[model samples]
Target: MTGRATPRSGALFERAQSVTPGGVNSPVRAFSAVGGTPRFIRSARGAWLTDVDGHEYVDLICSWGPMLLGHAHPEVLEAINEAVARGTSYGTPTEPEVLLAEEIVARTPVEKVRFVSSGTEATMSAIRLARGFTGRDVVIKFAGCYHGHVDALLASAGSGLATLAVPGTPGVPASAAGETIVLPYNDRAAVTAAFAEHGDRIACLITEATPGNMGVVPPEPGFNGFLAQTCRDHGALFISDEVMTGFRATREGGWGLDGAVEGWTPDLMTFGKVMGGGFPAAAFGGRADVMGRLAPEGPVYQAGTLSGNPIATTAGLATLRLATPEVYAALSATADTIIGAVVDALTAAGVPHAVQRAGTMFSVFFRDGAVSDFAGASTQDTAAFAAFFHAMLDAGVYLPPSAFESWFVSAAHDERAVATVLDALPIAAQAAAKASA
Candidate 1:
């Protein structure tokens, strides 16, 4: 499999390198951590990707968690097609944006949602609103939480940063990074301690509702509730970043798994991924009063030219409309089957491993024991994962190229797709077992 040909992808890589940095737009897409030619996808539909080289693979990446219904869902395509015929971006108010916002408000705890072009913008604007509303300068974020490349939030992000083994990227200014306090994920004492000292000056504390970047590290029971209470006690905002987990993880996102059960809600929440239906749309929302701080209302001042592009809004609205209870049930069942198979395969190969899950999202860590923090997640055997990754690819299964990221599945991942992954596991697991640290 390692000797298999990838001339088309390889040639494209060389051509791209001459133009783009690292031959990819996103750092992880370069496959630097996994050591392989990144497959340039020619087309994707219903859990399968056809590469430029004409090789087909079951797509477990799901476009990094956005393809909830799977690639090229017919209904979603129809909605986008209808939207396109009317207009793409009007740079003015549209009905799709209004309907999308209403749909979001109905599903989650948000009262008013402001649309954005990407997850980065959603989080960035939420952070600014937190600062402006509270009149504070400092923000606290958990280590290993990747809330996009927003300057202040990138202080100790995971995902691409973890894959590349970089402590933090170099371009962020000292002053920008300095304002952010990085805390360990799932550590209550650290949360208490950080708030104890900086309670008065902290604007907000943002965290992934259920982190998937440094593997799928779910919050410890009562951890999110604790954070909310602490922020409330200090008059600071609690901003939950659900860009990766929203709609894809569950109907109500990560909040449904914990916040709903705990009867707690974040002051502000960010969303993307499945909500966009594979298009570039995201949002931030919370209590109407808190959101009222935005420009056209109070004074926070956030705007985007293509913020609520008609086409993107239509796709998101249609996706959310179709995300029924049955869809969520299928997602859970699919995750259960795949995750169980992964554990069985790794165990059969005598490979020490642990699987972490958050609702429908999950990841495999190449080590033995429960991982609750980034330091623990960092100890995964990259060599073992790289070996397994390539083996799975050879067998026509495309996993997220990094062990630090979650392997996404969709409603489109029918029994056939699951069987494809199951059949490849033993071979990949054996490959992983042979690799040494």
Candidate 2:
């Protein structure tokens, strides 16, 4: 398949560069790593994006994992339309917020949830609440696990930071960065040591529940459970940052893969992406005791004018209501088909690759062996990935532009969408092999 010319996207990008930094709101969308004109989307429906250039591609990005049922899902649209008719935002409380919070509580381990406008706020507020509840200052975070661009968490974040090959970002005060201890992911020894040295001063340890930021580096078996136990021992709160994985990876999110089975839960948890149903809603929640420390209740003090916006909450609630066991089953089945084909295609093309998965989320790392941590994930041949990425784009499959991001699939990804991706894989795999050679 030959992609339609992106003349309009090229023109828009040129215009945008004069106004917006790097011509994009998010750095990763610049396609800096992938080396191509980023497609400006015109609209999206079930499993496809129609770009400004009039090219239609199977959407594997899924709006960075928020489109659980898929873009413009009918029920979600109806909910938003009804909500807009009632009113957009009110400084006062709304019914949708309460209903949405209750839906989250029913599915996950969180007992009480506080709404936020973005994943960053969810994580940032959760950390503050943890410190307030514990009376400690230090926090632990895993390298390559991006909670968001919250100043402190950006110290060694993955996602855009990794794509740009930036080390700890500048502008974050040395003092603020000093408060966080960054440890290699999946390394229990590093975690134990950090807690041992900073136990009394440690307020919390935050991690991506399955870590989709650094290309889906799944926690080693029992790793999350161990972190929970170690934090409990040290009197630190364990904050699971599921901003990317929540409700997308599974019906219960990443916790379903481990915590649900182990009968343990994090002291606090952050959620975003799928919970918002393609809108800008996110949340942080956990034990009622820890959450009680937030303002209006106790005194940690975090507020947002847009917190629990009626439209966003209505969309989120509608999405959650539709994300049944059948939705998850479809996602897993679609993922299995695509992942298996990708492996076979790469192997046939003589390209060394490793496909890692966290529940239904997965990524194709351009290297051999298991990528269990940031160090391992970092070794991927990004040049080869770039070549593969462009080839797939030309073939009408939209993948995440960065190798350090997960490929998202939605319940709307039917066999037709899966076939579009499968048809592109062998050719893209060959392109990767040629680039390496």
Candidate 3:
């Protein structure tokens, strides 16, 4: 392990490529975005991933924000183990779903919630519900916000749109994306123009309340508010896709912190990741008027075969119950400690960098000051970032693989783990400087 020995992950990659596409289920996991072999994690405990190579890193990715309590808290594991004994999928209604729904309804700005298997499913179905409810065809989304691989959302206009580099993924027909009106994020004027041009036909303004997809760009002050007002004015539903930020954003939730503080309540909200507590559970629901449009209650049809599976519900319930104010407090304090140390380390090393934070969710952008939109975020030095990433990975610190991704802090990331990461920053920053040079 001294000279960076080849991990068993390399072998696994070879074996996996034969069966799985690009040796990864998810495109990002393929390490295609960042040049290298993906680390195959063997197991994890609080705040750390022990890879197959036996290298231990303080995990900041946190399983894309679902391991909020850390890799396998005893309670969550106990909940899952106990649940598996009961059976995995029942394909019928279970009381746990009701309990989870009740818990979710009691928490954020939503009346009811419908469980789905993934964030993609949540947003996809949520859009359908909006289109059905409003009886309109068009949906407006921000330029950089990723709502999953849904056909309507897999759209980018320009050369990138046709080649399918970023937003425009291959396989989705252009007509499927015709109804989607993509606008620059945080640009109120652009949004106004879109609204003015096609307000009547726009069914919903669906956006991440705070977008992490475009390199952790927090919404500009009043941007979300503008979206809410515009949707209200246009008779278009407002859908907040809070899959990544739902619980990790603050002591309450993403909407609980950012949106509620601004007094903007979206018509629909989607939750996944942390709600599932490392399981495949997600949901989208909001004002009764809109949520009621979904099947059984109305004409709009949305159903998942594994929706509200007992294990996922139990995991969600357990995770939610454990994420008390105290846990959020711990997460914030830990994040502050880490971000401060990282900034200080980079500054001392003379590396131009800035960190963006939304509650416990944050990202270290390889540039200075604020990144309010995707265009500004694109200015980040990805090469410098790739060097920093590899340095961190080598130093036993696991950040999000891509520069655009957010680094998550969990309740389980105590002082020890934070210190390991803080210590690694100087080395990473130094490497970043050299790489940029």
Best by lDDT: 1
lDDT (Cα, tens digit) per residue for candidate 2, span 193-243: 777677889999999999988898888889999999999999999999988
Number of the candidate with higher lDDT, 1 or 2: 1
Candidate 3: what lDDT?
A: 0.85
The residue ranges of model 1 lying beyond 4 angstroms of the native Cα positions read: 1-3, 156-167
- Provide the clashing-pair count of each candidate structure: 0, 0, 0
Tens digit of per-residue lDDT, candidate 1, span 301-379: 9999999889998999999999899998999999999999999999999998999888889999999999999999999
Model 1, global lDDT: 0.90
Instruction: Score candidate 2 by lDDT.
Output: 0.89
**lDDT head-to-head 1 vs 3, winner:** 1
Worst 10 residues of 2 by lDDT: 158-167
- TM-score, cand. 3: 0.96
Q: After superposition, how far is residue 149 of candidate 2 from its true place, in Å?
A: 0.8
lDDT of model 3 at position 260 = 72
